[model samples]
Target: MDSGEKRLNELGYKQELRREMTLFKTFAISFSTMTLFTGIIPLYGSSLLYAGPASLVWGWVVVSFFTWFVGLAMAEICSSFPTTGSLYFWAAHLASPKWGPFASWCCAWLETIGLIAGMGTQAYAGSQTLQSIILLCTGTNKDGGYFAPKWLFLCMYIGLTIIWAVLNTFALEVIAFIDIISMWWQVAGGLVIIIMLPLVALTTQSASYVFTHFEMSPKATGISSKPYAVILSFLVSQYSLYGYDSAAHLTEETKGADKAGPIAILSSINLGSFFQHSETSYDFSYLYDTSNETAGAFVPAQILYDAFHGRYHNSTGAIILLFVIWGSFFFGGLSVTTSAARVVYALSRDKGIPFSSIWRQLHPKHKVPSNAVWLCAAICIILGLPILKVNVVFTAITSICTIGWVGGYAVPIFARMVMAEQKFNAGPFYLGKASRPICLIAFLWICYTCSVFLLPTFYPISWDNFNYAPVALGVGLGLIMLWWLLDARKWFTGPVRNIDNENGKV
Candidate 1:
């Protein structure tokens, strides 16, 4: 057996997943899932609406700094407990025996549901990007543009979900190879936009405007407080930076996972943050420089159309660039589906999911979690169907993406901090003396962001403008606790070991 398989045996799991992914492929999964193009493009105009250019630029710097601490802490824990179950598995092993089961259960459900929600959100955003492309190709937003109805968007979302699920059901090697391609697509495509924008734009914003502009009027963001608006704007950066933990979730299929998994998590953040910071600056600057007719539309696609039209008087350039952005969402959703399926399979392997036997099963030939892939697809589709009419519900559902993911991540880091005296094994990527301090900062940042996410984004809140994130989170947490009290508490004792723990034998 290889060293990875031997490590699995020590963790009491027989090696089942094919460890074909090398370090680059492993990093690709995390980087593609955290696609900066998908994250920044859709939210760029809206983020500028919050606190102008300063929030988009400086908020990223601030959030990225703290997010590095978060990634560092997660990487340290992942280095020690390199498992597909990831956050929850680390929680069970790191926490006290008395609290292990409950802690793991919460983390598992949070992480699992969070990932499904993220997949749905990414696909949904891709569908929206598709609609925006259609609008731009036909005409400008103010002219005879085609505005897709809600039903059309939902259909596109379902179609994308099916495509992602089918792709994820392929063998690990196939998906890992695609992930590498996706990494390049995001990197090269992003570079094209970053370089091409300032070149072709009819005008450009001054440096002072790009860095120092601040707008927090009651008319601008529905709030008058600069501090609150700035805090609310951090969501754009925080949301984009997350889902990097996909590396840890795929460790079972990764060679030299104990080292590769931790490295992927941190590298994804470092690389993604660098590109996003640069791109966000350019995107915001371009938006400001566009004509008032386009900038007032408050949509990135509209800005692109206006920019290209000013120089070339054609929409084809804008159309092609919009497709580039759409590709980011496409590849991003695929990687998220891969990560979500792994989470479901790992939880089911321990009998944590409702239908553990079915979800835990890998394809006989491909060795992929085929059933779990479909399970995620079905859940995301169901979650998405509401967008046909009650569109606000989609916003509410996507809100869980950030809170649930970071909440799951924080649990284990918090557990490790509280249980510092426990017998812990450091992996090759150990942090040495800075571990606890990093964990503390990471945990606190998670807490602060979670709280901020729950607050209302718009003032004078009503049914339409209310931030229902807290409601969605509360209901989900309540159901998990209720299920634990009623059913899972009886038999669910954290992760199940298929192999003997002491002797590493079946």
Candidate 2:
């Protein structure tokens, strides 16, 4: 057995996942999960409407800096405990034995829910992108295009979710190969859009406008508070910078994971932030000149259409570019599903969730978590069901996605500071003296962003514009707590040791 497998045995896991992923492919998994196209495009208009180009540019910088602190803290812990359970496992291993189980359980539910909801958010956005593509092809603009009903959009979301689940059930090598391709696709495609937008645009805004502009139209977004609106705009950046934790969740399947896993987590954040900044900096420069109505329908798509149309009087170029973004979403969802399945498998191995036996089972031939893949798909479909009744559900879903992920990330980091200050072990990627400071800052930022997203986005909040993230998260946690009080506390200890490691150490 290799050193990674040896480490797994020491940690009480059986090395069930194939450790075939290389450094590059491991990075690719996280890279794809935070795809710029998947995260930024859906919320571009809302961000613009909130604080204009400055928020997209400067707000991204602020969010990226703090997110890097979070990533660094996570990387340190990930190196010490390179398991598929990731954050929860790290919390359990690092916390005091008396409180370890409870800490682990809390992180597990938060991270697992965040991951599955991450997939739901991506697939839902992909469905809308597909709808935009069809309308563009049929000679329809946002004003006269074929608008899909809520039910139809939900159907589209379901179709995309199923496709991602099916793809994830393939062989391990196939998934790794697809992830490498996805990384390149996002990098290359993003650069193309950044460079091509200026080349084809009828006119572009100056750097001052792109970097210094700020606006908060009370009439447009129903908020008059500039600071609050700017904070709300940070969602675009926070959402785009997430999903890098997929690296930690996939470490069991990664070679040299003690080092590579941490690198993947850190590098994905750096690279994703760079690309988002560059692309949005350019897209917004041109977007302000485009019609407001067109930009409102879908900012990125309409920007591409207007750019190419102004130069060539045809949207063929825009349509082709849209396909590139759609491809990014397709690959991003697949990677997310892969990561979610691994989380499910790890959680079930310890009886953390209902139906542990089934979810923990892997396919005989492919050795993939086929059951878990479908379970994630099913849950995502259920989450998307609310989209059928109201369009504002999209706002709520995105809010929950941000809150779930940010809160999940903060728990383990906070635990490391308060519970494992001296007890925590360092691995290949230790931060040494810098670890505590980084963890403290990360935790603080997470607390701020979580609370900010819960506040109402619209000023005069009615049922239509209500931000339901707080409600959804409250109910989900309440149910989990209810289960704990009734039954889980009796038996659910965190990170069950599957292997007989009499001489092994964690």
Candidate 3:
């Protein structure tokens, strides 16, 4: 066995996954999963409505820096414990022994729910983008035109979710290669939009308009002033910057995981932040000159169509750009499925989920978590069903995802800072003296953002406009606690290491 496999054995687990993913492929999965198009395009209007271009541009910078620190904290722990059950495993081992099981249970469920919600939201957005493309091709705008029914959109969402499940059930090498291609697609696709949009625009706004212009909606239900609005605008960046933990989830299949895993986690955030910053800046620059009604209506799509209509001679160029974003969302769904399935499989292996034996089974021939893949897909479909009743359900799912993921991230970092510091051993990718301050800052930032996500996105508090994140999170946590109190605590210890290597010196 190679050194990585030997290390896994020493850590009390056999190499059940196919360790064929190279460092680049590992990074690719994380990068592709955290696609900017999926987050930025759909939510662009909300950010603009609250804080306008200034916040969208500068807020992302601040959020990215803070997010990088969170990644650093995560990567340090990942280097020491490179496993598929990354967050939960870290929480369990890092917390006090008396509280480790509960901590692990909470972290596991939060990560699982967050990932499932994430998958649902991405697929839902992809479906909407697909519909938009169809509408655009048929010459149908928001005016009296041939708009598709809600059922059709639901069908498209389910179809996309199925596609993700099928792709993940394939050989691990196939998924790895797809991730590599996804990385290129994200970079090249983003560059095309960044360069082409400006070239095609009849007129571009000045730097001052892009950088210094501060506008807010009079009807905004949330924060009103530009200063507070800017802080709230950080939500867009936080949502997009997530899923970088996909690197840690795929650790079992990654070569040189201790170092490679940490690098992938940090690099994904840095690279995604750069691309997102560039794209948002350019889009907002042109959008500043467009009609407020149009900018507020469809955000990125309308902005692109208006800017490039003169150059393309029609809406054809704009449709092509939408297609690029749709493709990125599709790829992102695939990566999300892969990550969520691995987490489910890991959780089940330790008897954390209800049908542990079934969910934990890896396909003997392909070495993929086939059962968990389907389970993840099914849950995503159910989670997305509410979108049929209320389109804003997508927004609610987005909030739940942000809260769950940020909470999952925070638990381990809190433990590392408060409980594990004295006994913590530095891994190959240690942060040295800077670790404590970084963890503290990351923990605080997570708390702040999580609070932001819970607030209603729109004012007046109508049922349709209300954010259901708290409801979803509460129900999920309630069920987990019920299960724990009823039976889990009696039998469940934290992670059940498969092997018993005395002193880990095998």
Candidate 4:
């Protein structure tokens, strides 16, 4: 019979197998899709202050700078150690085992939970966007409702989750194929929209009217949305840039795994930033707002139809964008599942979880963790149901995801810095001479974002502000801390210490 340590080694080997991602395929899949889905212009800044389109536009510019810093920090870290374990691996190897196990657990907890929640929002956003396009195409109107019915949304969410679960169950190569094809479609669709929207607007309306006469349509915050313009604008921009962190999450799967992953992430954001600035500055904000709405309401569909592709009613453009973005989102969402499952699987190898047997299952056929995919999907579906309650459900979930995931950023960077100071391995991609400056800037960016991350989601803060997003985030992290103290420390310790590779682990 195998001893305890031998069994742990066996499980750890399986986790490594999952990390063997195809580099070229990884880049093609990530670049094409993340760029399209995340390039969503409407949600990025318009969701901002409602204070004015200009403010949201500026906020995006400002956020892009800070976002670049965060990306740079992540790039350096991923390059140093491009393991599938992500930050969890960094935590385990870089710190002493006793503390390292718990620290890495925190990273995994944030990643697993955050990705699940983030995916839920992605599903929600993609669905609503599609819903908007459909309504616009058909010119359908249901008086006074901001969204589709609860039942319909729930059913659709479940359907998509199942589809995602099935796709993820196959294996990496299959998933990569789907993502690559969709990524190209996504890139073409996004550029077309970016170019077409402005040209169409200019030909239809005077440039002055398109840029100057655009109006604000802020969702009610029960306070004057005007005075706190910057805060509101920041919130709006936050919506657009919220999940680009997924690029870092995919680091383990990329070729030159460590370096390319972070570079791709930062690069994608840079492209996204450029597009947002160009598109927002020139495109008619009014076309994005009331009366001349773009993708949100049916009127925009009519305007687009009247403007760009009337005969097809812009359906080809709209549907193509939707399909590309949805496909992007699905791949990103699937990455979340795979990452989450691995976290669970990794923690299990270290004896950090319950039901380790199921979540840790690997497919003999596909060589992927089929169990982790479905398990994470099942959890996401359960979590997604809360959206029926109020608008806050989505915000709160997203906010919590951000805090957890970004916290993933902050903790690992700090831990890596301290380890380097103590003379750790420094791995294949280590910065060496570059470590101090990179680590310091990383430390600074992480601290700054974590602070900015505290501002109320609804903005225009007050006693009645009652924003629960920050609350949800705090509770989520606290629970993770609590879990570590309660259990993780007992069995797991630093990447199955004294790993003997000569004979192969399993």
Q: How well does model 4 score by local distance difference test?
A: 0.57
* TM-score, per-candidate, Cα-based: 0.94, 0.94, 0.94, 0.80
Task: Give the range where candidate 4 is weakest over 10 consecutive residues by summed lDDT.
Answer: 1-10
lDDT of each candidate versus the true structure = 0.81, 0.81, 0.80, 0.57
Query: Higher TM-score: candidate 1 or 4?
Result: 1
Candidate 1: which stretches are off by over 4 Å? 42-45, 277-298, 502-504
lDDT digits (tens) for residues 10-52 of candidate 1: 8889888888889899999899999778445536225666777
Q: Local error of candidate 1 at 399, Å? A: 1.8
TM-score between model 3 and native = 0.94
Give candidate 4's root-mean-square deviation (CA, Å): 5.5
lDDT of 4 at 328: 60
Q: Give the Å error, residue 493, model 2.
A: 1.1
| Candidate 2 structure quality by residue, lDDT tens digits, 205-289 | 7878778878666666787887888888887777788889889888888888989999999899988878654333344433433
Q: Model 3, which residues run further than 4 Å from truth?
A: 38-45, 142-145, 220-228, 277-298, 420-422, 503-506
**lDDT tens per residue, model 3, 1-506:** 65556666766787788888888999999998998675445363266667666667777778888998899999999988888889998899898999989889889998998898889878977876777677667764544434457888889999999999998888978888998888898888888887887777877766677688787774544555655677667678878888999999988898899889999999998888886543333444334332332323245566567766666657788888888888888888899899999999999989999889999998888989999999999999998788678847777888888888778998999989886566875668898788889999999999988888887666667887777889888888998899999999998888988876775532
